[model samples]
Target: MILCDIGNTYIHFCDKYRIWKNLPTNIDKKNLQADIYYISVNPENEKKLLKAHKNSYNIAKIIELDTPYEGLGVDRKAACLGIDDGVIVDAGSAITIDIMHAGRHRGGYILPGLASYFRAYKQISPALDKQINFGISLDEIPLDTQTAISFGTLKSIVSCIKETIGGKKAYFTGGDGKFLAKFFEQSIYNEMLVFNGMQLSIERALKKYEEKK
Candidate 1:
C-alpha cells in the first residue's frame, strides 16, 4: 500500500521509495507498485493526482479526509487518532503538537519547523547568522546566540507540553520526532501511525459501504 501525506511544503509518499520525498513519472509499478493509495490532499492536488492515476492503477484507491472542522491538518488528526491521550508532537516541515485528553482529541499547536526557525534566523539578521543542527538539546546549545535562539525556543515548547499535559501519553512522529525524543521520554516512535489511521478510515468507510448492500 502507498500512503501519501500531501503536506503544505512536501508530499510524503510511502512506497518502495522509503525516504525519497518525490517520484518521477517514469517509475514502474513493479518497482514501486502499491496495493492501495491513501492520501489527504487538497482539492488542487487531488485533481492532478486523480487524473494522473486514472488510467494506470485499477486497484488503487485514494481518499481525501473530510471532517466537520474545516481546514484542519489531516496529519494531526491522524496522529490524534493513533495515540491514547496527551499530545502528539509531529516534528516535520511544520512542528505541530496536538493534544488529546481522555480519548478525545482536543486540538493543539502548530509552529515553524526546525529548519524554518533556523532559516528565519539566517535570513533576518547578519551577526546572528549561523547554521544550527536540529539534533542539539537545551543543554548542548552551543553559543548563547544560537542557544537562546534555538534551545530556548525548543525548550519553550517542551515547557508548554510539560505544564499543560504532563501525565498523559505522548506520541512523537514525523521527520524530526526521533531526534527530539530525549526531552520527552514518555513519547513513542510511530512512523506509520498516520498511514495506519488512514487504513482505519478505509475500514470504517468500507464498513459503512457494506451496510448499504
Candidate 2:
C-alpha cells in the first residue's frame, strides 16, 4: 500500500515498506500505481490526486463523525492518530499545533510557518530577502539581521509550542519537524506520522468493505 499526506506546500508519501519521500505540491502523475490511500489539506488537490489514481481511496469517504469535531480536516485527524493524548505539530507551509487530550481532539492553532513568516517579511522588506541559517539553537542568538529574523521566528514557534503543550509531550511532523525538534526537549519527531495514520485508515476501510460483503 502507498500512503500519502498532501499538504499545501508538499506531498509526503511512503510505500508499504515505510520508505518515505516527498515532493513539491505540483507532482507528476505519471508512473504511479494503484492501492493508494491519501489525505489532503486542500480539496482541489485532493480531487486531482484521486483522479490520477483510479483505484485510490481518500480516508475522508470512509470516516463518519457527529456534531462536534465533524468536518475536521483529515490532515489533522491523521496527525492525531494512535496517540493517547498530547500535542501534534505539523510545521509545514503553515504551522499547525493540534491538541488531543483524553482521546479527543481539542482543535488547534494555525500560524505562519518559519518560511511563511520570512516570505511575508521579505514582501515588506525586500532588502532582507536572503537565506538565513534557521538551524541554530535558541540560546545562540546571531547578530546579523537575516539570522536574527530566522532565529526570532523559530523562537516564537518554540514559545508557542511550550505555552500550548503545557507539560504535555509533543509529536512533531512535516518537512520542518526535524529542524524544529532541536528546540524542544520533550518532543518526538516522527516523519512517518501521516503514513502511520494511513495504515489505520486502510484497516478501517477494509473492515467496512468486508462488512458490506
Candidate 3:
C-alpha cells in the first residue's frame, strides 16, 4: 500500500505500491495497485488534497480518519506510531506532544509554534515581536525575549514530557526536532517518524479491511 503522511508543505511516505508523489492527471490505476490510502489530515486541507488528486483522474481509495476525537489533529496520532510506551514531540508550526503506551494513545498538548507565536505577537504589538531566525540556545539560559520565548516553549514541552510520560523513551520529529533534542536529557529524532506511523496505519487498516471481507 502507498502510505502518505502529508504535512503543511511536504508529503512523506513509503510508496511500496509505487504511487508517484507527482501523480499524473490521467494515471492508469491498474499500474498502481495500492490497497488503501491512509489519510490523516484536516478536513479542509484533505478536501484540497483530494481535489488536487482528482484533477489527475485516478483516485485511490481514501480513508479519512475523523471521529471519536472530533477535534483531534491527525499529526499527533501519526507521531504516536513512532514509539511504544514513549512520548513524542513534534515541533513544527504547532508544537505537538502525544504520549503513547502499548498500543493505546494517550492524548497530548499543543502549543503555538515559534513562528506562530511570533506572528501572533507581531500582530498584537510590532514592538514586542521580531523575526525569529533560529531556535533558542537550549544550552544556555535565555538572555533575551526571543530566547526566553524559545526557552519557555521548549521548557513547557519538556516539563510536560517529564510530568506525563516520566522516563519513557522519547522520540522527537518535525522540523524543530534538533532544536528541541539539544535540551532533552535523552531523545531520538527521526524526521521520517510520521512516515513510519503512516505505514503502520496502512498495515492496520488493510488488516481490518480484509477481515471484514
Candidate 4:
C-alpha cells in the first residue's frame, strides 16, 4: 500500500520499500499500482489526488484520535498516533509540539519554524537576516550577532520543549526534525514517523471496514 502525506508544498509518498516526494500536480502521472492511504492538509491537492486515484482513502475520515484541541492538523494527529507516550515535534514549514500520554493527546502548541524565524528576522532588518547557527552552544552567551540571533531562537525553543516534556522521550519528524532532535538527549528522529501512524490508522480502518461488511 502507498501512504501519502500531502502538504501545501509537496506530496510525501511512502511504500513498503521506499519513500519519496513530488509536486502535487505530478502525483497523477506516477501510475502507482497500490491503494493509497493518505492524510492531507491541502484540500485542493486532496481533491486532485482523490480524483486521480480511485483507490485512495483519506485517513482523516477513518481515524478518530482522542484530543480536545479543536481543529488540530491531521499531520499532527498522524504523528501523535504512532506513540503512546512522548512529546512529538514536527519541524516542517511550521513546528508543532504535542504531548501524548497513554494513547491520549493532552495538548500541544505551534511555533514558527527555523525558516520562518529567519524570514521574520529579514523582514525586521537586513542586518538581522541570517541563517541559524545550529552548532552554537546554547549554554554560552553569544558574543557575535549571528550567534546571538541563533542562540535566542534555538534556546527559547529548546527550553520550552525541555520544560514541556519534563524528561519524557521526544519523537521528532519532518524536514528539520533531525536537527532539532540533536538538542534533546532523550529524543528519537524518525523521518517516517507520520507514515507509521498512517499505517496503524489504516489497519484500524480496515478492520472496521471488514466488520461492517
Give me the runs in candidate 2 sitting further than 4 Å from their true place. 20-31, 63-71, 140-142, 208-213
Better of 3 and 4 by lDDT: 4
Shift of residue 166 alpha carbon in model 3, Å? 2.9
How many residue pairs clash (N, CA or C atoms closer than 3 angstroms) in each of the candidate models, in the order given?
0, 0, 1, 0
TM-score, structure 2 vs. true: 0.85
Candidate 4 lDDT over residue span 135-198, tens digit each: 9998899999899999988998889888987879999999888999998999999999889888
TM-score, one value per model:
0.76, 0.85, 0.68, 0.90
lDDT agreement of model 3 with the native: 0.61
Output the TM-score of candidate 1. 0.76
Ranking by TM-score: 4, 2, 1, 3
What residue runs in model 3 are displaced by over 4 Å at the alpha carbon? 8-38, 55-71, 133-145, 208-213
Write the candidate numbers in order of decreasing lDDT.
4, 2, 1, 3
Each model's RMSD to truth, in Å? 4.2, 2.7, 5.6, 2.1
Best model per lDDT: 4
Residue 131 error, candidate 3, Å:
3.1
RMSD of 3: 5.6
Clashing pairs in 3: 25-56
lDDT of each: 0.62, 0.74, 0.61, 0.87
TM-score for predicted model 4 compared with the true structure: 0.90
* lDDT, model 2: 0.74
CA lDDT for candidate 4: 0.87
